[model samples]
Target: MKNLKQLELLEDVLENSSIILPITINGKRRSEIEVAKDTSKNEIIALAKEATSKWLEEKSIIKEIYVPNKLVNLVVK
Candidate 1:
């Protein structure tokens, strides 16, 4: 198990190992998504968007995908 902020090679990330990544809206923590350690950055972003869509305002936009910190930030009107 890897702690948050610990950097590791993708090859060493196993499917069975997962983490709860933080999802933020306008720099505020909003939701969380459990994803495999091997999940790609794009996939993590998609999951964050889906998980937070309900509370997302109209015309909301994803602003950042910071994998190192396991955080997905969104911009909302």
Candidate 2:
């Protein structure tokens, strides 16, 4: 049986755990990135770019960021 202390610890861990957000490029789902729950828009975008950097071309650039949808659009030449 789980004790109250164990439950509280589990809850704390979950509260601070990172979340996986889907990354979209050109309106298409390309990959997913993990970030903290309290991560800001800019931080999320940076993480997404880093996660998808290999797939992105040298000329690729972030054109839009939809934080609510956890999506980032990249324009690749």
Candidate 3:
């Protein structure tokens, strides 16, 4: 995913995958929803998309969905 310097774009991907990505902002994950990319962005985004697609396609598999607490949404306020 291209860094927007703000990560809101990841919201959809995270929602669809039902998984939180762990990001290192200021050295710690704001919650636990940060995506890890060790190589080219193209490769990383593709990987994330692939994983999410697989999770969606596997209808029988149950994935855990974690909703961030209210406090986590307070940073902008």
Best by TM-score: 1
Query: What is candidate 2's local distance difference test score?
Result: 0.76
The reply for model 3, stretches above 4 Å from the true place, is 1-38, 54-77
- Please give, for residues 1-77, the per-residue lDDT of candidate 1 as tens digits: 57543545553554357888889888889999887777888888888889988877466574655655367887777
Which residue pairs in candidate 1 have backbone atoms (N, alpha carbon, C) closer than 3 angstroms, thus clashing? none
Please give the TM-score that candidate 1 achieves against the real structure.
0.68
- Candidate with the larger lDDT of 2 and 3: 2
Ranking by TM-score: 1, 2, 3
In model 2, the Cα lDDT at residue 61 comes to 71
Worst 10 residues of 2 by lDDT: 62-71
